[model samples]
Target: MGAITIQELTKSYGETNVLKGIDLAIDDGEFLILVGPSGCGKSTLMNCIAGLEDITSGELFIGDDNVTSVNPKDRDIAMVFQSYALYPTMTVERNIRFGLEMRKYPKDEIESTVKDVAKLLQIEHLLDRKPSQLSGGQRQRVAMGRALARSPRVFLFDEPLSNLDAKLRVEMRTEIKKLHKRLGTTIVYVTHDQVEAMTLADRIAVMKDGIVQQFGTPYEIYNDPANRFVADFMGSPAMNFVECIVFEGNLIVESGNQRHEVVIPNTQAVIDSGLETVILGLRPEMITEPKPHAESGYITQMQLGVQVTEPTGPDTLAFGEWNGQEIQARLSPEVGAQAEIDGEVQIQVDTGKAVLFHPQTGARI
Candidate 1:
């Protein structure tokens, strides 16, 4: 079993703490992505898991064996770095074989292993080429091949696609997912890109300032965020948190001197929070182009003055104001066909799917 368990893991440097008591688990063959901004301790946690950094305190287990104190090479893990850390002068075949050769495997065995790994990574044609001669994607594949040849207990990827061009990064993301499916390898990938975390992770651990904000499946992290930070961090267009106040179990949303009271879903959390002022969180897609039969949702229309409309291929993003705070909504190009700066536009709202957060505490209610 390649399952991993982390218990109260904490790492510090000098007087500066990096990881603040992290607890996590990864089932065998599960793809767990560690995502957060730079200096959020994601890379530090990864180093701890790979036995490259000494933990300040806590336990880490790999398949029932505690490996927190194990040496890096003996921890049975391989890491693919963002820089595609291949030997510059060494041929791809030699780079892939270097580790096995260092372990004193026989020449014939090394040759066989290299051939199989090259075939697996589809780098057979480039095996004789130096790292400088290969493209970014090829170098990354070769780096992956080197790790794959070892057949380690776990694979740690430290933003392995960050260096590639946009097109290559997308291609590599899909390729990496395919590799995971084919090999069924337990992997812990680190990335700052939310898109990568959303698209690639079986489970995501979102961190900030050495603390794990939330940990769950992509859908849960996106839809059922624990707090405002997580909700704002996960989405593409980002969620709009409009200022609102509660009055008699209904939300009072004011726009352009006009007021609208939308019914909120009654739940225990709302009753428990007991806060009158709230921030209504809604996604751009929820505020869409009005349809003839937009009667399905808690639809409310307001004469919002449009500032600018941006067409983003699939959907157009229109900028406006809610309660005098800048807000954005998604609209169809045809529906926004006549939208202009400072023009009044009727925008629909989906209050049913809206989330409420305590304005003071920023916690979801």
Candidate 2:
């Protein structure tokens, strides 16, 4: 069984707390990603799980056994590091077989494991070459191959794709996904790239400031974030936040002489809270070129003064201002061109899918 359960996990260095009360669980064969910006203690938590770092207070269970005090080697887990950590002098074949040999496995079993891992990673032809002779992606594969040869209960990937180039990163990302599906092994991956977290994780634990801000499926974390930070951090272009004044059960957005009132689902709740100001959260894709007609009261049609347009192949990003804050709207190429030329364009905002946050606390209202 590869299921992992972490209860009240806390890691501290002197008076500084790195991981503050982290509690998460993953079933057997589940792929979980720990993601956050640099210095958020994601890597530290990974080290704790790998037994490289000791936890201050917590209980960690892998399958049925509590492995909190177990040595890393005895934990029955394999790790793939960001640096590849390959022995440069040894050939790929030796590197893959090193772990099995260190465990004193039979010669036939070692050879078979090396062959199987090399074949699975599609690096059989390159197995005779040293680490210095391989490309970045190949080196990463050899690193993964080394970890795979162990066939441990859980696989730990610590920013394994960070060293690869853009195109290679995407390629390796797909390969890792395929590998996970094929092996059906539990994987705990750590990365700061939310795109990687979203693409690769079965469930993601978004960490920040030594704490897990939210833990859920990619869809839940993206669409229904617990707080404003999660919403702002997860998206590429990011969620657009505009400070608006709540008036008469409506949120008001103003630009120059024009005014737009957006009706949100929780307008009454926000009004009842006696909060006069709220931050309106809208994804870039939610604001687009004006449709033929407004579907409901939640959809507001307004004129947006596009200051800049960025062409991103299929669609263009139109930048405008609303409520004294910059806003990005994803529009079709033709619409973007028109907005660029005309300076102002009609846009529709689907507030039905929009969210509201407390202006002071940045908490979902």
TM-scores for the candidates: 0.92, 0.94
Question: Lowest-scoring 10 consecutive residues by lDDT in candidate 2?
Answer: 289-298
Top TM-score hit:
2
- lDDT (0-100) at residue 292 of candidate 1? 85
Per-residue lDDT for 232-326 in model 1, tens only? 88888889989877776777887766999876666455656677778888988878767688766488777767888888887788888889887
lDDT of 2: 0.89
Candidate 2 lDDT for residue 70 = 97
Residue 228 shift from truth in candidate 1, angstroms:
0.5
Runs in model 1 lying further than 4 Å from the true structure: 103-125, 132-138
lDDT of each: 0.85, 0.89
Lowest lDDT 10-mer window, candidate 1? 335-344
Q: Candidate 2: TM-score?
A: 0.94
